[model samples]
Target chain A: MKNKTILLASRPNGVPTQENFAFEVQDVPALQEGHVLLKSLYVSVDPYMRGRMSDAASYVAPYTVGEPITGGIVAEVIDSRNPQFPKGTVVMDRLPWQQYIVHDGSGLSKISPDIAPLSYHLGILGMPGLTAYFGLLHIGDPKPGETVVVSGAAGAVGTVVGQIAKLKGCRVVGVAGSDDKIAYLKEALGFDEAINYKTVGDLKEAMAQACPDGVDVYFDNVGGEISDAVYLKLNKFARIAICGQIAYYNATSAPTGMRVEPILLKKSALMKGFIVSDFAQNFNTAAKDLVTWLKEGKLQYQETISEGFENIPQAFLGLFSGENTGKQLVKVADREG
Target chain B: MKNKTILLASRPNGVPTQENFAFEVQDVPALQEGHVLLKSLYVSVDPYMRGRMSDAASYVAPYTVGEPITGGIVAEVIDSRNPQFPKGTVVMDRLPWQQYIVHDGSGLSKISPDIAPLSYHLGILGMPGLTAYFGLLHIGDPKPGETVVVSGAAGAVGTVVGQIAKLKGCRVVGVAGSDDKIAYLKEALGFDEAINYKTVGDLKEAMAQACPDGVDVYFDNVGGEISDAVYLKLNKFARIAICGQIAYYNATSAPTGMRVEPILLKKSALMKGFIVSDFAQNFNTAAKDLVTWLKEGKLQYQETISEGFENIPQAFLGLFSGENTGKQLVKVADREG
Candidate 1:
């Protein structure tokens, strides 16, 4: 039996293209001792993966040419060589962009199908959930009766940050790329206000109108005018968690410019940055809390699924274009529903 | 008796000048009810005063035209109308740049003559001392053996920051304008290393050599390229207390373009801006600890006394020229000493 796979053919200078990735089918190798055959059900396509595709220095190394692109996945153990696991056990793990894989279950987490839709392991209940959870709670430290503003509010992580801010008794405002996304941010996520960056005539005025008391906590996912606008409205002792800067990711020229120093001085605020991977050791505790929140319906999450393993790279590329309104993921195979 | 006085005549566009002040000779006013006639001894000249001169809006209100420029002072009550303060009592308080002041003791903090020299109140045991205290301990929380860097290290606040960092068991590096100031900072403050920014040929390489184990805590006083160079050497989770930006005080045009997003993304660090005034509420506790340290000889301080109340405006202007090494103060009058 053979499985379809996607490999990094080349590293793109700027925005990635289809030419940079090559699709191929290869026969599945026999499982060794303590190795389990994983049939990938869902493959995650995240923004951080872009940094891993280039050879430039980052927290993690880039994907080598002619190698499979690896990331988060929800897979099912069809054939097992390990004594601990039998056949047909479902799990969430980090693996390559392929339909099947043989790997150890050490880092793989068991996912109960009765609790959640298996695909959520690729998004809200996954790393993005923890990103918003720890970033806002630990770094942003939003207080009750305070105003909290989040950039990239329609994205997986940003969406969770705003909702969590609301749960913490904060007035939540969201910034998104499109009108529909903005509406969903407010109506679906319970954000107090939503800003459509595309149609907003003046960001500063819009932000001022939305956050009258000034922002007490700013969870920054999109770093550009959105971050700068929220920065101007920070109250005294405000805290900002810098999650990501998607705006300058694909730029071939120098990065964008903004005068942000006066904001800190004016408000006596703090700006801290971190990645979810930094808290990898505490993922178990965060997962338990996240699962409870999801089951209780206190937390809302959305997944934009693209069907078929052949369309995995296309789904990945769509992230930069703002094509996915929620967690962008690809479904490779069904898990016996 | 007639005495010299310098008052804030007007606010400046950027760097304040003599034209922005009014110098005059007036008879010392008579004491009123519950007020003491103080013979001004030492008046502090601080960088934050320049910020107070601007009306563009900040954490504190701008100084009004034709009013006494208010800051830290050490004075002697030659004539007293209040029973609480007897005649010939020495006090540390907020007074104007005048030979004498007759006013209620609203913000006055009395200083015993047995304590260190009265001028120390304007520098080490006063606002600057409290500023360096909280800015380092609370914001720039350094662990023992960590590398800490302080800019403007020979200045009033910067000197204390370096010394306090040393007491905290960190490898301290100070960045000053001249070799003399650097030597004073290293030798007197027990700074592990001192870098004269003006003579450094390559800032990045120099920082790398001085701080082989990247900077863990940065007490920033001068912001600009020096700040940019320091940002390059910050370790993961570094903490920066943006105390002052003496470098940008004279910026007549827009700041030079540069991006520091790498510090945020790569290091996962925090940068916080603070005013000495913001930490005013905590001054009592900070000063208590500071006074004890000073008494025990664990903490040290220096002053650059520019002579005469007539030089008050020029003394303030000299801050931009780096004329004063440590705490810049002006003697309004010598009470028959």
Candidate 2:
């Protein structure tokens, strides 16, 4: 069978461009024993994908030149040689920007449509969901009545973090780029307060007014100036879980790194960095809990889906501009999410 | 009777000078009921005193000019109207630095000489001892067979940290100044390894050699290049307890604007600053344990005694140059170890 694929052509210096990615027409080889054939149902385009495009060492392996870019995707198994995965079954696998994939069923996970949207697994009930789950609960450790300040508050991870903090009895405050996202963050996602960082003149004062008691747990997904300002107002013995630095990830060399020793010294605070891969052992527990949260309507998700394999690059680029509220995904074939 | 006292004359710039201190003799007035006339026997010279000399804010209150400096001291009650503390009952008190203090018996803990030297209550059995106890156990939280690196390892707190870590089954590595101090750290303090930072060209390389598995717990008394280098070698989830930054205490301003943000991001480490005052509630338990350890010969202590109350300023200034080993103390009158 014929397949369409998007290959990483080069590593970009700053924001990735079309020049760094190339489209390709390839053959889908016959599946061997205990294998299945997958037709791409939903292609997940995420901000974390930007890290995989670079050669720098990170939590996940970087994509090499000429290799297909891979991310979470839901697919329909058209043919199967494995007893566990049957024909016409819907499954989730690390599918690249490809039309079809022949897999040995090793990395594929079966999914139930009755659970939620197939695309939601690419978001609220999938990796992004689990990322927010463990990152907030394990690292944030939000106590009842404590204040939680989350950067990237309108994004996939941030949205979940705010809601989870609320569930845990914390006053949830979010920082985002646009007013619309902020509105959605506060109104839709049940956040206590949302600050449009782009519109705010004095972020420190604004954050202070919102969080009068000071932040006890800071869920930092977007690092840089926003994180810097939050670092100053941290309460004594505050816990900061460093999930990602999407804001600073694109810097060519380094940012004008401010001094953080004062934070540790004055407040006796703790700052920790982690990737979800470290918690792979408990991925099931995290994913199951996330799914339960979504099915119960306690968790909400939003995705900006770009149509066709041709617009995958644009969908990936939307992440840098904060154009997507939750997860950004690319739709390849007929599938209702 | 006439009593002499040393007062904080002015806030210090960089390294403190004699000009920052004022020595004056005041006439001793008659004590009232429930009051005692006590003579200061030995005064402790500690790095934390530098913070008190600065008018700037800190965890502890800064000392004001024209006010007598107060810290750990061993005193002998000359005359007691309180009836609680009799004459010649050696005790520890947080009184103004003077040859004689005429005040009510408050915040004074009577010391038993049968336990150890009276001077040790000002060193191993007092605030420094508790600081090491809590900072290492609760903050640093070292585990069995883990590599522990302690800066200023021959100093009062550092010596106790090494001995305690040794008892905890950790491989204690000492970083100190001079060959003699290094020898003392290894042979006397029971540190598994000692690195003379003054002679080592590259502290990071030396640390790597000493702790091949990487540093687990770092008890930092100095916060300069050596501490920064040790930070680079921190293993995953390492804990650093910032006891005192004696290295930068003498600077006119703060640090020469060197960014210390990497300590948080790169290592995913925890750096916590602390003052012994925060652990006042645990004073009794810590004192009993330390006193027992000393009597059982599990712990050892050394005092660099600079004779006379007149040399208190000199003794404090010497801390910046690493001139003293173990605890630095000044004998104001007839005092015995």
Candidate 3:
């Protein structure tokens, strides 16, 4: 069988571009014992993928030049020598941006379509889901009547975070880049208030007006001026969960903003930075809770999926431009039964 | 009796000077029922006092103009209407910088002279000591064989923090502005490593050399470039206790530095800013442990006494210049029996 893969042709100095990627066509290797053959069905293009494209030190290892870019992928088992992953099994694996992958079944996790759609595993039932789950519940520790303000509210993690805070009986406020996202967060996601940061004359004033009571927990996904304004209105003993700094992800030089030490000291605030994998040990518990919420309709999710194997790079790049309204995914091919 | 008091004459824009304080002579009021007359002995001069001198938002309320400067004072009971505090009884009180004060015994805490020196209550046995204890044990949570770095290592709180981390069986590194402070931290406070930030050509390189194993727990009393260097070496899951930001205490304009969100996210680190009062519920427990350590000869403390009530402003101003090695106190008068 033939396979097409996207390779990292060059490292990006800042924002990644199509010039940084190259295409390669190769033959899919025959599955050995304990191995499985996967036909890519859906590929996840996440904001965090931007971190792996650079050579800088990060939580995960950087993708080297000439290697295929790998991330979360939902695939169908075409062939299996492993008993655990039989033919026609739908699974989630950290696979390369490829049409087909021959895996040793090491990191392959079997997915049940009965739980939700197969594509949901790459989103609300997957990494993005677990990120919001642990970051909000464990780190945020939102209480009833407390106010939760989340950045990137229209995105996958932010949408879930705002809703989770709402379910916890909190006053939920969201900050996004566009007016449509702001409307979606308040109208569709049931957020108590939403602010379009780009349209607001003064973000601090808007945040103050939205949160009559100061922010108790700030779920920061898009760090920059938006976060700077949020810090100003944080209540005493506020908890700030630093999930992503996507605003500075594309900066060529060092990023500078309002110094937070004085604000943090005055408020006695707790700012913690973490990736979803940091809570790997508790993934099962979090995943179970997420699945239950989705089943009960307590949690809602949306995805902006681009079509074809070749658009994976574009889908990943679109994240910086705020082009996608939820989880951004690339549909590679149909699942083979 | 005539009493001399130091008042906040004017708010400081940046670093406070002698002109910011005003001296006044007032008639001492007769002690009412349940009140006692206190003769000030020793007054503490702390970096946090700098914050109170400025009319800015802080953990504590700003000192209004013409109000007497109040802080930790070691005083002797001169006369008592309240039988609970008899003459010659030594106590620690949040008293103004005055030669005499009549107290109603509301917030006054009696100190046992046998535990350590009477002046020690304003240092290792008082707020700074409690700050080092809880901020380290509760927030930093240093474990055995881990690397703990403390900035402002020769200051009152920083000295105690390094010693406490040592008792916890961790390798402790200290950073200070002067060579003498660095030497005192290693020789007197038992810190395993000491870095003179002023003398070091490259702070990041020096920190890398000193903390070859990487920093596990960081107790930051001084924030700025020193903290920036330490942030670079934080290990995964590192905890930073932000006790004080003395480095930016005197800045006239807004302080700016490298954004920490990216580094913190990559390391999965936790940074918490706290005042000693945040752990008030646990102060007694921490104080008991601190007193025990002092009695056991496991803890050592040194004080730089600036003699006379008139020298209180000078003592406070000296904090910015790094003049004092350990606890800086102004001796107001001789202990009266």
- Give the top-scoring candidate (lDDT): 3
Model 3 docking tier (incorrect/acceptable/medium/high)? high
User: What would you estimate as the lDDT of candidate 1?
Assistant: 0.85
Scored against the native two-chain complex, candidate 2 gets a DockQ of 0.39
Which model, 2 or 3, shows the larger TM-score? Answer: 3
Range of the 10 consecutive residues with the lowest summed lDDT in candidate 1 chain B: B253-262
Write the residue-wise lDDT of candidate 1 on B1-337 in tens digits. 8877677788787777889998778887766789988888888889888878877667777888887778778888888889888887788876677787887877777787677788888888888898899899999998999999999888999999988888899999999899899889877778898898899989888899999999999998888778877888888889989888777665665354455554577678888988877777788899888989998999977888888777788998999988889899987767542
lDDT of 3 by residue, B1-337 (tens): 9999999999988888999999999999988999999999999999999998888888888898999999999999999999899999998978898899999888788888788888999999999999999889999999999999999999999999999999999999999989888878888888999999999999999999999999999999988999989999999999999999988999998788988887788899999999998988988899899999998989989899999999999999999989999899999888877
Question: DockQ winner among the candidates?
Answer: 3
What's the C-alpha lDDT at position A195 in model 2?
A: 93
Tell the DockQ for candidate 3: 0.83
User: Candidate 1, residues A200-291: lDDT per residue as tens digits?
Assistant: 99999999999999889988877877877787788899998888878777766546365456558767988887988888788889888888
Q: Candidate 2: lDDT over CA atoms?
A: 0.83
DockQ of each: 0.55, 0.39, 0.83
Question: Which wins on lDDT, candidate 1 or candidate 2?
Answer: 1
List, residue by residue over A44-118, the lDDT tens digit for candidate 3. 998888888888888989999999999999999999999999999999989888898988888788998798989
Choose 2 or 3, whichever is better by lDDT: 3
Using lDDT, rank the candidates from best to worst. Answer: 3, 1, 2
| True-vs-predicted CA distance for residue A169, candidate 2, Å | 3.3
